[model samples]
Target: MLGARGGWQALRGCASLPRAQPAVRLRVREALGAREPAGEVKVQGWVRSVRSQKEVLFLHINDGSSLENLQVVADPSLENRDLTFGSAVEVQGKLVKSPHKMQNMELKAETIRVVGPCDTWSFPLKMKERHPLEYVRQFPHLRCRNNMLGSLLRIRSEATAAIHSFFQDNGYVHIHTPIITSNDCEGAGELFQIEVSWVEKLPETHFFNVPAFLTVSGQLHLEVMAGAFTHVFTFGPTFRAENSQSRRHLAEFYMVEAELSFTESLQDVMQVMEDLFKTATNTVLSKCPRDVELFHKYIAPAQKDRLEQVLKNKFVTISYNEAVEILKQASQTFTFKPEWGCDLQTEHEKYLVKHCGEVPVFVINYPYDLKPFYMRDNEDGPQHTVAAVDLLVPGIGELCGGSLREERLPFLKSRLQRLGLADAYEWYLDLRKFGSVPHGGFGMGFERYLQYILGVDNIKDVIPFPRFPHSCIL
Candidate 1:
């Protein structure tokens, strides 16, 4: 439709258009360990330290991509007078080899511009001093600027990705379970109820027509999905109204739960949990070696060998009766005496793991009365045990808990009636009535896993924002 002269003009105009410029900025992690020298580059990060001499000024910058900060050597004439600690700045320079023993490459700055000015006297973090984690925890909003917390956050992110990859690669469908649920999975009765209000209210009215609470576990919901999908998992926030201020408990935390259908054997559930732990730990160790090293050297020195032992050895498996015998014959004094039907305490779990060479061990087939109503009955006469499994590690006891579900309708109804919870779970009984397969699932506390891996003493230090009994700051 166009003439030759017009077509030629349009082509010339298109040729004259400007192309998009390529990005020139490199992260501090890349800038510090660049294999080849880059002629000209741009870097942006927060200044960790500023050392000024008469001729040259040395600026250490970090962007949280790595544990190490990149050193920038700038001339005195580059207008770096305001480059104090914690100041955000953009640096334009050439990447070159550094003579310093700490790092490999340094940025030779031609121009330095301040993006945000920081007052050194008012900043909470000191330049060259290491602050205690407890002290830095007070400033929840700014603690990410510190090296330890920053490294921890990076490792957490990597671990999350590794977990997702593991599940996805193994044909597991990620199910986003409901956060607000009507049923309590644990049956511990420690639930936080949801309250709602309206400007124009009726005499007796509530949101859901009944009562609701934040979910304590996603295992029940994952089981619902597992009836349709072969393998399903959920990783999300779970809440509990626990009043204790123990370092091991959190009012709000994350849980990783998985359910598998057509699984009658308890070994299937234990095998999946073991593989997940080993795979995720291996991935974190390979990807975050430096961050793990930081935690090993500073946070927990003894945890390194323990974690290695867990990865190398096959997890030991034992029955609950065997564990009870061991505890009864042990020399260690316990607060609670070993009984046949009692639940294993943290001390007992730790002793069991230690008895098995300080590696992870699975204690299976617990007493039927100790578990919830959903667990399948093993029907062992006089002993009366359920097909339940709990994985205990050395540093942290009871890392994971799971059980084979009761697929028979009559048995489930009878068990629920005995527990006085039959009326509250009619829909659950329907799952058994209308074509239910043999299913099982497990729940792993995400914060506890982080604490186990990072060797952090308190669970609060591992999470970004901790919610416990009396504290919910920021």
Candidate 2:
């Protein structure tokens, strides 16, 4: 250890040294957006294609920043055998106007260096061949190299940013909810329990003294925060062990949940949900026009007009009873016919959307027995109902679900007791005892939302790595 004087001198010596600066680099999107040619610029990316001629070698390089690849023109002498499709390389070149009509600029390479060599025979992706989405799903580890999936990822990133901005601008406090908890928000009895192995005899007590599981939703935690903050939101991963193999179900996915305090009725919650959907969609459409167009042109051509209609039309609202009545009168036959007390199936939801002129529609006032214990009782005389709502869109059935929470302590305790869950939710009951205001919230499945927006039929394609029943590929 150094003395005081020695330490001070050492500190002064350290402070006199120059700090290191990060190396300057430009993304492909940024480079392409330049107004004038850049001199002596350096670019590094994976080669998408390479063509060799007697005089010159042309390479198409992509950095996953945009759908379009950077055109690189190199002298034949600088070409190496490793500079093939999917090989990572760095080039020192000058940017110049391209003679080709496809792109505006090209890189005139002075020197080329191979950073990493990819085996063309083993690579799943091929040059100049369009691979179907299902075909690319087999290679989750390398699917981001494809132009379509890469564009989807970029759009997803932009949408996430837009959501955060929307919440922050609207005075909502962002909260991080716990990933492990003892209580299930949905009470669906489909939780993934956490278990730990023991070296010796099995321990009598669990890790948390009680059972724990991956959270199904962040609504309860957001509600806790809402008790303090007027408006709170959480965006994170949520898990469900439904063992569903449908196109819209996932074992693990992302959810965006928001809780609003001092809400008077269910309409307030519905309005916020509608606003969030529109705002985020508009932001994505404006910021990622090319990527959105790519999906529309190739994947789902019919979705473009539907999306425009969704943005333009006011979402239709109807009571659950009205929806059931309409379904009952429809000429279409159903496997599970629409009933008054049963939960709405995907077929019923799709029919409702189509009936509403192919626009988003909100069905409210669901039967009390159909919803969870936390929903507020509407007390509508003979047939009881809950102040709950579900937002249904054209392609996807139910996009969002929310309700006004039960603020009455006695009613909440009674409902919990009836469900045989009062002991597990003592703390939740205490929230009402201390001080509870009229509050409501909704949860939107991020993957499903992306699926509806991009018009991707399979939920697996929207997520980077999909987790489902009997499938958990990289």
Candidate 3:
């Protein structure tokens, strides 16, 4: 049942796949590392541990198949005996009872099959202990050599797949937003500019002819497509030039952005965000129990518990003013002092989540100057700006950010004018004038969520081939 996908009907007459050959096989973990198995069995894996004593050799082998590895005992008398660490080999032997306590069962190898022998000079990773920081730098190649790292990457992949599947099943159209753009969506002055020499040869007159920058967020472009399609989302790389070398910051990161059209209010956008977050957390927990266990033991138990709590509890919603008031009264330890008009720093965000038991908190009604022009104007308070929501979680500062878009052309135009961004967003202004309906959406940093779920400390570790301030390793 575990091997086949479509049950008995799909494999009715398929002779190629035998009933004995399951879709996936599980190795006997008890037969690991100098442990003799109870009977005869076939063992296979990469060499993990090897200890030789004159005539006999003991081997601890791993297949990267599971957390547990297999042990093979090799004799020096073998005709073609050649093997080392990182070598690929297969062992045929009798599964006998184990005398060694390290592994439950041991394999009495009758024959050895060496697929490939790893050259001693070429293998850089030794069995000796390696420092964490140095290992991360030298770890690009040998990371998969360890079981825990492999498990974390496996879980990360599953979570990514779940993200796409969750949106696709909900009838969300996948939109491909441009990475290079003319307008800055966040207005935070963090965009990475893309410059070329096209205008360099044209003298001083054509110096400003070509202008483009890597997009910090795909919200504005996705809004253009959201008006046509009821639900549209973009999953791609977003860049920021800010040189903050914190655990939560990254120069280049993946953003899962969605814009829902014809929305009732900001509440609708928040609800969608809640749904997406819950789905991703639940899917990862359900699918990766082993990886979750490893992450809990080695990384941070608080991160895993925080995600679980978020899935169960009703997310707390508070306005920016309310948050400011709470920060003023709270006794939590925060490095940055929170003020009414000032932006909530990482320390403040972390403190708020911890106060709420580290569950997801929706901070809404931000100051107009803090948020962008696309948000719907909130006319209730003193500041009549667009409605915006930022979902803050434990470990990660702002996991998700969304706002109800301003559908009115005049208000959007005025907001653009006041922000001194009219020239850059003339095309975006066209969306409001041309049959724009009530639309709202949010963008979640995919790597940020992965970092939280996996309990990984740095954002660079979660993303493959990360592009940070000082490093861009292929």
Candidate 4:
């Protein structure tokens, strides 16, 4: 936002107006909500559009407070080169009832001052031009001025607040997990190891005295906290060095993770995931109706009805065997064939969601070997599986993944020993030594969740600064 004027420039615009009622400074959103007719007032915002007529000049200005712009009707004499689109300006005027049906109030400008001037010829965005997401994405520094991104960020903020409220209201203690850690929660080996600028390798001489890397998930640390606090949650940035540029993959992203102690069933974890999604979605819709409507109206036309169905109905659940069977019988051929032990591919996940009426589907009881060592073993038979679950939504395939953690000492010890991680995770083994309880947790990709709800095809657009393969734009 443009800074306020100092000394004399502060009172210049409003002071020039014939003072009957004292001028009140109101934001664009506040001015737009006038009932009858407010007296002298002042508003400041960036110029969105300027329409000059023979009698009057119509200017639409916005201050990023809302999606809608406040209409400012000024005399044609007030129009100048500096009042072009994308420039910052302040207007002193009388806020009166608008005769136009589109809005409730309009500003009858007494004076207009251009606070900050913009070079219109060099501006990436143009007046009355609805730039596509891909095009606007190129200008990362200035793309927020675009309507699509502005609406997305607003909705993202609301959803973030709603998530925090959901956990806090449900008796969960929030935790700040570490950004750099020695433990890999998922055991995927995809990590961004930290390094000093000039040093090559620092083992004993290292700052931390051991290898450290950016976190892949906060689940492990949350589990440590859950031992003390029955319920705990973490909402923060997590990183992975994945080299893919798929719409669903990002090198840097956020995860919403929660852990619950004294809960043995995957059903408990699944219930939390479903509840969190529905609660956050409802809040985002209520708080940012028009912003959400922008994506539904223009980006994805069918999303409105699709979202309603998801919110109103209960999520469907199927065992991993059942999911594999459904996929095997499907008439559609997949790039990766659906097998019992193989992890579900994005293609397979999309088909499963569509097969289940486009609602979120929870696939539980995956093969024991397919999941990480932390997941509790199902302890059944030749075709063995574990108590692991993944939530699949409509467009994006897997929105969340969770499992009931291995609580028994012998079971977890054996699993870690087989994977050669027993020595590395001695501290984790100590957690079981100190009276462990049956517990489970799940992690949902925050950006993926936003992508799912907003109908945004590209994951890059939902985040402010996307870090991906060979590209980290400011």
Best by lDDT: 4
**For residues 159-243, what per-residue lDDT tens digits would candidate 3 score against the true structure?**
8888899899999999999998877787878877666567446443323465678899888888888868999998998999988
In candidate 4, residue 211 scores what lDDT? 81
TM-score of each: 0.93, 0.94, 0.80, 0.93
Clashing pairs in 1: none
lDDT of 2 by residue, 238-344 (tens): 99999788999999999999999999789999999999999999999999999999889899998988899889879999999999999999999988988889999
Q: Quick one: ranking by lDDT, best first?
A: 4, 2, 1, 3
Model 4 per-residue lDDT tens digits across residues 265-362: 89999999999999999999999999999999999989989999899999999999999999999999999999999999999999999999999999
Error of 3 at 341 (Å): 1.1
| Clash pairs, model 2 backbone | none
Comparing 1 and 2 on lDDT, the stronger one: 2
lDDT for model 3, on a 0 to 1 scale?
Answer: 0.78
Task: Please list all clashing residue pairs in model 4, or write none if there are none.
Answer: none
Judged by whole-model lDDT over C-alpha atoms, candidate 2 comes out at 0.91
Candidate 4, residue 146: Cα displacement in angstroms equals: 0.4
Candidate 1, lDDT over the whole model: 0.90
